[model samples]
Structures are given as structure tokens and as C-alpha cells.
Target: MRTVAIIGRPNVGKSTLFNRLVGQKLALVDDRPGVTRDRREGEAELGHLSFRIIDTAGLEEAEPGSLSDRMRRQTEAAIDEADLVLFLVDARAGILPADETFAELVRRSGKPVVLLANKAEGRGGMAGAYDAFSLGLGDPVPLSAEHGEGMGDLLEAIEPFLETGEDEDDEDRAGKPLRVAIVGRPNAGKSTLVNRMIGAERLLTGPEAGITRDTISVDWRWRDHPIRLFDTAGLRKRARVEDKLEKLSVADALRAIRFAEVVVVLLDATIPFEKQDLSIVDLIESEGRAIVIGLNKWDLVADRPGLLKELRADAERLLPQVRGAPVVPLSGLAGEGIDRLMGSVVQAAEVWSRRVPTAKLNDWLAAALSAHPPPAVSGRRIKIRYMTQVKARPPHFALFGNQLDALPRAYTRYLVNGLRETFELPGVPIRLSLRSGKNPFEGKKKTWD
Candidate 1:
């Protein structure tokens, strides 16, 4: 896909424009400057045009070897990789010394630039928009990103730069790779595990905590099956996440989870099942992705026999949402048990995509309701009429019944557990959607009982 990068000084509504183009809020937006530190990429569409878009950090001049400098390097890297650059400026704030500085920087890169004067909804910003011609990039495309004003003009400006061609055929798309994401707390050997899996040192790894600040995806094949593995930044507790850069990294990792089909929650075996670890598992279940618990750093705990059994018990007890998940003990550094881990991953993906027939699902629901009837509410029994599988990729079901909104939490758990056990659907989260029909005899002067 043709790539375009959004670049400019801090807080020029770059992320807001990015979210608008992608038709979703994939990037975090804040009023403060420098809210986005690392670059994030998403597939974007404008009218009939389709291409990949990148949201980069705010360009800044900082001291050598500082965090700000690192962010600058990421932006420069994006500029080098992009086919076109959308240089944005705050029309309301007017052109400043920083804007002039980055304009020179983007000019020296020799790439095609589309000058954008953002936040120009009224006549107040037109004076600054007219003054932008002094930068020598071109005429500015004035538009308000917040309210989406003047998009037709903006589209007319960039249409010539986009590549035009037919898309790939169905046979080519049938071979698409499976997406798997590795996520956990800081310094839990996620990058190391990725390196071992791909048999190459592609990612930067060290003993320090939080060495990775971006969610990197690597494409490879495993035993003839193509796979795309996502190595994400370590997620920390919200109370302790005080750094703005770390917050961006966490948001990137969460986007990775929502993109993947199966998620591997790698826990440090020495201190397995901490509060943070459980929290991570809960997040995965909430996302409704297939779960695989990886007990990394197992070599250090090899002397203690029967610890794996105890941890298995702990997993079943602590995380009932993902009970019966595959827990594999392996050392990412030593590369032990990788084959078993891959096998479990493939199996989990199959279960996650499995579909049950409507007849079979209705039969199971009948047996379950007969064996243990639903509890009464306000001296009336709730009726569950029928059930059917709505979709797959972590099985989702729809239940049609009367007064379904008043169903108790315990009864919902009972149904979910029964679905998991009876259908042989393990480790993947099941979604039960209650759909109730309105009563017809309401306010009828006691016409029916």
C-alpha cells in the first residue's frame, strides 16, 4: 500500500485527522503538546481513495541521546519510509519559529509535501493561512480537522499522489496469515520470545525494563502456515503510568490486542500470577480473543518440581473467564518447548474460529434449561425461548427470551459455563447477547394474565 505520514510541530490536530481518516479513534488525543511519542500506522480511506497512513510524533529539537531525541528519530524514520508527507500547521496559533524550523527540515527531505493549515473553520485563521505561503512548501489546504470542514478540497489536493490499481484477487487473500500478539508487563521476555520464534534478533532487547516503546509486527511462516507476530510494549498499572510516552505505548499495545486473533499472555514464572498478570488476562477476556498462558523464564524455576501443577490450579481458580487455557512452561532465552507452544497456538486459533450449527445449539440450550431452570425474579420465572450462535472468532451467541434484561449475573455465568463445557469450546471467551421482545398486553386493564 502507498504510505503517507502526518508531520508537524506539537498539538496541531495530527491525531484527530488520523482518526478521522481511519474512521475510528485508534490514536489517543490530548490538549497537551507531545501526547503522541511513537508512530502508529492504520489503513485509511477518503471517498474512493484507499492507502496506509502514519501518525508521527511532534517534531522537536532536543539534546543528544534524550527521550525527545529518540522521538525525533522515529519521526525522521517515518519521513524516510513514506511516499508523501502531509505537513500540518495550526492556523489558529499562527506560524511560529518551530513551524519555520520543521518546514526547512521537511523541505530538505526532497519528498512530495501537501501543506495543510488545520483548525481553519472561520475567518480568524485565514490570515495565518495566507501567511503560510512564506514557508515555500505550496498553497496551504485550509480545513478544520475537529469538525471535518473542507475535506473535498483536501482530497482534491492529494488525489494525484495516490497510486491507482486493482486490488488482489480472492485466491491471493485466502492465504492471509494468522495474527498473534505477545503481551505482558515490562521486561517479561516478550521481545526475546519473538526473537526465538523467528530465529533472528530483529528487535532491540536488554535487561532494562520497558526497552520496547512501540508495537512491532513481524511476518513469518511456521511449519508451512503463515503467521504475523506482534511484539508489544509492556503494560503497567494505570496508577503508576505517569509518563506520557508510556501511555502512548500502552495504547499501541491495546490496538495490537484488538487486531490479533490469538493473544499470548507471557508471565514471568518466578513471580507468576501477580495482580498485574491477572489484570492482563481479564483485559484479554474482555476483548474476546483466544488466550494462551506462557510461563516464561521456566529454566530458573526448574529446580522446584510440581510448581507447574500448582500454577495450573491457580490459573483455573483465579481466572474462571478463561479456564482450561493451555499453560506451557518454556524459557524464551533457552528456546525450549517452542514447538509445543506453536501447536497450542494453532489449536487455540481453530477453536476460536469454530462454528456450531443452529440446531445443535438449540438442542444444548434446551438440555441446559431443563437440567437447571432459571431462578425467579419478583415472583415470576424468566423465560429463555431459544438460543443460536451469532458468530465465531471467539463464539458469540444470541438468546431470545422475555424479561432477559433482568437475568441475574450468576445465571449468565451458568449459561456461559454450560456453553463452554457442552460445545467443547475452551479458552476462548464466549459472548451471550440477550434479545427480548416487548410485551403486547401492556396497559390493557387486566385483559390477560
Candidate 2:
């Protein structure tokens, strides 16, 4: 894959431009200068070109004998690994001494450089663009990174250097087996449950809680589907956390949650509803991933009938975001309910990956609106005209309507629930977005008329 590095002095909108190019906030951005101390990488596409873009720490003069030297070394190492460099400068601040020094350093590397004069939103930055000419990096591409201006010029500048072979390989890998993470509080029997499903003593069993420190991923075949299962450390509340190693373990689990396509949150049967468990569910919902609940150690619960009723009620009350999600009961030690647990995992994953055809999606929307019209508000009746599925890692629906700004949360939830039930999409998160716009053909006569 072709590599491009965004190199610049601090507070010059490098991270913002990085986010814009990558189409995601994979790198952290802040107003404070030099907030990014480490190099971050993300895959980016411009028109038909695709490349790996790296965002590096700001280029600055390091104190000869301080921690700043370490940062400078890291930044230099990242720059050395790039095929092209985007040297960004703050046009509002004009060309400074640091910019001149970095320009020489980048020129010496002999890589293709695209000098960007960022913050060029208005007349205030014209003089700074002129001043940037002294850096000898050719004409600057005047841009406003925050406002998403000058993207065309920036893309044109680097179009000749992009390589395209990697895109074919990426498309080939898109349908490969998914990675799943199983996590919850300590003593939730996550390891035991995973071992039961795999039919081996693959993970260590223990009576003590918090036995797993590092997140362990195991690759196995279920029926004919290839699966990678991750057993993560039990997450504890922030205030209760003490040791640094445990804190790091929690962070690792969180990272696994982000990396995995599906997350199975194991809950102790006896104490199934806790604040931490709810928080875990909320995290998965916020991350827009599919989730299934495993009520493990069910063999230990004495009141089986009453416990089942309570569990159902609690799940509905706590996780309304993912309504109708599957909650399977299993005893990992006894190898009971393993089939149901695996079945639920596969079902939820299938739903997570499912895509709806645009024609069928709009057809369903038309029928649904006819059956139950949106409520009237402020003497104006809400008219939902059409709908489309924009993007679907988990199905996200976009609705074009009149007066959609007044669409109530309850009505949105109602549509989401209807979609889940009608489409057989259980245990996966579904998003519904409403946008208001005027019809372009509102006053025109139809040909059929």
C-alpha cells in the first residue's frame, strides 16, 4: 500500500485533516498544541485512490536533554517511513522559524511533499499564504482543514503518487470470518463458557475472580464458519480500579470491544443486573456493534422459574436501546445450553452483517407509514416521504421527511423496533436517521398524470 504522512508543527489542523481524509476520528484531536505525542495510522481513500495515511507528532525543537527528545525521535521515525509527506502550516500564524527548519528537513528526505497552508478560511490568512512561499516547497495549497475547504486541490496534488493494488486485496478480505469478544464483570464465567463452546479445556478454569489479565483470542471453526473468540479481562468500575496493570487490562478489553464485530457480554445469573453490566451494554451500543447476552452459571441459581422472569424484565428495562436482543442462559461447567449460546451468536452476527436492498427498504417504509402515520405537531402533520439504507455494518436507515425535526424519540424507537421485528434482525443495533427537506418536484406534473 502507498503511505502518506501528515507532518507539521503543533496546532496546525493535521489531526483534523487526518480525520477528514480517513472519514473517521481514529486519531485524537485537541486545541492544545502538541497534544498528540504518538503516531497514529488509518486507511484513507481519495476518489479512486486508496492509501495508508499516518498522522505524526508535531515537528518541534526538542530540549537537548529532556522527554521532548523522545517525541522528536518518534516523529522523525514516522517521517522516514512515508512515501509522501503533507507538510501542514497554520496560515493564520504565518510561516514561523520552526516551519522553515522542518521544510528543510522534509526536503532532505527526498519524498514528495504537499505543502498545505491550513486555516485559510477568510482574508485573514492571505498574507500567511504569501509568506509560506519562502519555505521553498513550491506553491502552498491554501486550505481550511476545519471547514473542509481545498480538498480537491489537495487530492489533485497527490493523485500521481498513489498506488492502487492494495484496494483489490482489501475487497477480497471483506467477507472473511468475524472476530468476536466475550466480556463482563469478574466471575462471569466468560472463559469457562468459551471453553464449553469450543469443547475443550482451552482456557484455564478457576474459582477465583479476575483470573484473566490479558485478552486471549482463540481461532476455531463452528459448524463450517471460521470464528475468532476473544476472552477479555473483566471490567471494573473506574473508581474501584487500583493497580496500574489492572487498569491497562481494562483498556485492552475496551480496545477489543472496538476491534471486534460482535461482543457477547456475560452476566452472572444470580446478580445479572448491575451498574457495571448496564455500562457494558451502553458501551457496546455507543460503539454501534452487535451484542448478545450470556447469562452464565445458571446451574447455580436456585429459583429457575422466577429468575428467568426477572432476567427478562431486567434486560428489557435496562437495554431498551437494543430491544428484543437475545439473552441465552447457560452453565459453562456442565456444558448445558452451549448449542443455544452458539446459535444466538451466529444469529446475531448474521443480523449484524445483513444488508437491505434499497428498493425493498423503501417499499417497507411506504407501507409502514401508510399503516401508522406520524403524529401531528404544532398544527403541521409530519409527512415521511422516502427512506434509504445509507451504510450498514449494523443496519442504519435514513429517512427523508417533512417536519422531521419534530420527530419524537418514542416514534423513532417505534420505527427501529418495527424494523428489527419485520426484518428478523434480533440482537443487533439498528440506527434510524430523520432529515427534513423540500421536494424538488412538489409543483411539477407527473408524466403518468
Candidate 3:
């Protein structure tokens, strides 16, 4: 796919535009300027054109020795890599010196530049739109990225530049399934375990730690489900990491976590309840991905019965975010319990991908609310009227109710726990959002009346 870079000064709605084009929140947006420090790439489609859109850091001429200089370098690198550049300027602020400087930089690159005068919604942007032509890039495309206005003109400008014809192997590319990352701390047997599961010498196996440097994603199939398995470098504490490659490897693992649908966090059986392990679990949960825990090198541990009880307790105590998650014990080197591990993965993934019907979900909600009524606030009883599964990769629900503003966190947990138990959803993160208001149809007269 052709690469299109969105370049602009800070707070110019570049990310907002990027997200609108990509149809996903791949980049974080906030009122704060320069929230984007890294170059984010996502697949975007405009009419019949599909391309990779890169959201780059805002370009600023910083002093020779400064962080902004580093940011400038990153932006320049993105500009170098892009096939087309969308030079964004704030229409509300008019043409600033930074805009002029960046316009020159874009010109120097000798690439096709589309000057976008963003925030051109009101009369305030009229003068800026007129002033933008002086930059000599081209007639500015007046756009309000936040409101999604003037997209037709933007598409019209780029349509001519788009390379014609589709690839012959488009079906194969479209059919590629999700890539999963399996990661954990040292001696977690991540590599050995992966080798065992693939039934090959896919990765090096040893008693030593930190054998994997680069994050290696191996493409394979399980139960006819196509998967690219990423075996990442074992993450050590930041203080203990001294090598540059290890730092890069750690970043690569994090990138993998961001991209993957399912992340298997392998744990060492000997010291499974470490703070670092908990941190990894928190990261996966925060990323809103499906997770499964594997207690590896289990053959080395003694007191199997007692250990199982303790492990369950630890999982409950430390990782309540993913309650009722499946924890399987396996020795990667010996190929023990490998089938159960794969089965758990498939089961967890199915649950993660599950979408509860609106009727069935409301039914579940009614029973749950009846069992444990919501707490009253200021003598007014809160009533949950309806519930709907808004979206799911790991299922997310939106609850509409009366006086739900006063709904207690404990009650929310109760509903979530009930939903998990009732639906048999295990080892996947679930989200519940509460919205309070009167039912729109409540005041309406019946047709018979």
C-alpha cells in the first residue's frame, strides 16, 4: 500500500484526521499539545483508494540540543518514508512561522504535498484559507478534521496520485488472520513452550535466560485457525536492562502487544507471583486484549496439589481485572499439558470474540439486577432499564438506566462478575459503561390511546 504522511505543527488535528480515515483509535487524542511523540501507522481507505496513513509528530525548529530536535528528526524520517504528504496547518490560527518553515521542509523533500487548512468551519478560518496560498504548496484544502468536513476535496486531490490496479494476491492478503504475542519474564519458558506447541525447532531451547533478542512472529495454524505467533524477548526490570538491543527488544514486544488480539502471558512456576508479572498482566488488560496465563516449567516445581491451590489464590488476589481466567500448568521442554494450553487459547479466543445478543443480554441484566439491587443514593432507588453490547473483541457493554450516575463501583463489579459467571466467559477482559437518563419512549402515548 502507498504510504501517506500527515505532517503538521502541534495540536493541528492530525491525529483526529488520521483516526477518522483509519476508522480506529490507533492514536491517542487529547487537548494537550504534542501528546503524539511516536509515528503511528494505520491502514486507511478513501473512496476506492486504500493506503497506509502515518500520523507523525509535529514539526518544530528546536535548538541544536533539545528534545524537540529529536522530534524534528522523527518527523523528517516520516517525511522521507512517505509517498504523499498531507501538510496540515491550523485554519483558526492562520499561517504561523512554524507552518511556513514546515512548508519549506515539505517542498525540499520534492514530494507531492497536499496543504490542508484544518479547522475551517467558521468565518475565523476564511482569512487563514486565503493566507495559506502564500505558502506556495498549492491552493489549501479547507478542512475540519474533527467534524469530517471537506473530505471529498481531499480525496479528489489524492485520487490522481494513487497507483492504479490491485495486487493479484489481494485475497491471500485479506485472509491473513491475527498475530498473537506470547510474552513474559525470564525463565518463563516462552521459547521452549512455543517450540513444543509448533512441534518443531522453531526457537532455541535452553535453561539460560534472554535467548530471544528480536521479537520473532512465527506463522502457523491451529485447528484451522491461522495465526502468527510472536515469541518476544523475556522482559527484565528496566534497571537491570543494560544493553541497547534489549531495550529495543522490549519496545518491540510492547508494539506486538498493541497489535495482537490475544496475548499469552507465560509465568514461571517457581516465582509466578512477582510484581513484574502483575505489571505485564495490567498492560494487557489496559490494552483491552484477550489474555491467558500459562504457568510454565511446571515439572520443576514440587508440591503440585498445594501449588495449584496457592496459584489460584494468587491469580485471584493479584489479577482481579481478568477474573475467572484460565491458568494452565505445562512443562514446555517435556511437552507436558501442551494440548490443554492450546485448548485454553482457543476457548479464550472464542469467548473474546463473542457478541451477546441485545435481548439475551437484557435478560441477563434483569436477573442480575433482581439478585443484587442497585444501592439507593439520597433516598432515590437507581433502576437499570436496559443493557446492550456496544462492541466486542473482548465484550464491552453499555448500560442505560435511571440515576445510574450514583451507581456504586461495587455494584458494577457485581454485574460484571454475574455476567462472566452466567455467560461462562473466562480469561478475557470485559467492559461495562453506565449511562443515565430517562427512557425516550417512556413519555410516549400508546398507539391505542
Pairs that collide in candidate 1 are none
Best by lDDT: 1
What are the models' TM-scores?
A: 0.66, 0.63, 0.63
Cα lDDT of model 3 by residue, 226-314, tens digit = 77888989888879988898899897787677557788899989888799999899988866678888898888885566887789888
- Residue-level lDDT of model 1, residues 1-449, one tens digit each, is 78999999999999999998998999999999999999999999874468899999999999999999999999999999998999999998989898999999999999999999999776566445655767899878777888766564566578668844357466545655778999999999999999999999999999999999999999988887788999999999989999999999998898678667889999999999999999999988876789999999999998998999999999999999997899999999999978888888999999998999999989999999999999888998999999877557778777889888789889999999999998888899887767677799877777556
lDDT of 2 at 13: 90
Q: Could you tell me the TM-score of candidate 2?
A: 0.63
After TM-score superposition, the amount by which residue 257's alpha carbon in candidate 3 deviates from its true location, in angstroms, is: 1.2
Superposed by TM-score, candidate 1 places the C-alpha of residue 194 at a distance from the truth, in angstroms, of 0.5
What is candidate 1's CA lDDT for residue 248?
94
lDDT of 2 at 35: 82
RMSD of 2: 12.4
Instruction: Go through the candidates in order and give the C-alpha RMSD of each one to the true structure.
Output: 16.0, 12.4, 13.0
Task: Estimate, for each residue in 1-449, the C-alpha lDDT of model 2 and write its tens digit.
Answer: 88999999988999999998898888788999988888889999763468999988888888875667787788788788988999999999988999999999999989889889999776567445656778999767777778766564566568656744445566534544567899999889989888887888888879998899888888877777678899999998889999999998997788677657789999998788799999999888866678989898888984566777778778988888887788888898898987787788888878887888888878888878888889999998998888776556567777777888788888887788888888887778886756577578899988973
lDDT of 1 at 348: 94
Q: Worst lDDT window (10 residues) for model 1?
A: 163-172
What lDDT does the true structure give each of the candidates?
Answer: 0.88, 0.82, 0.82
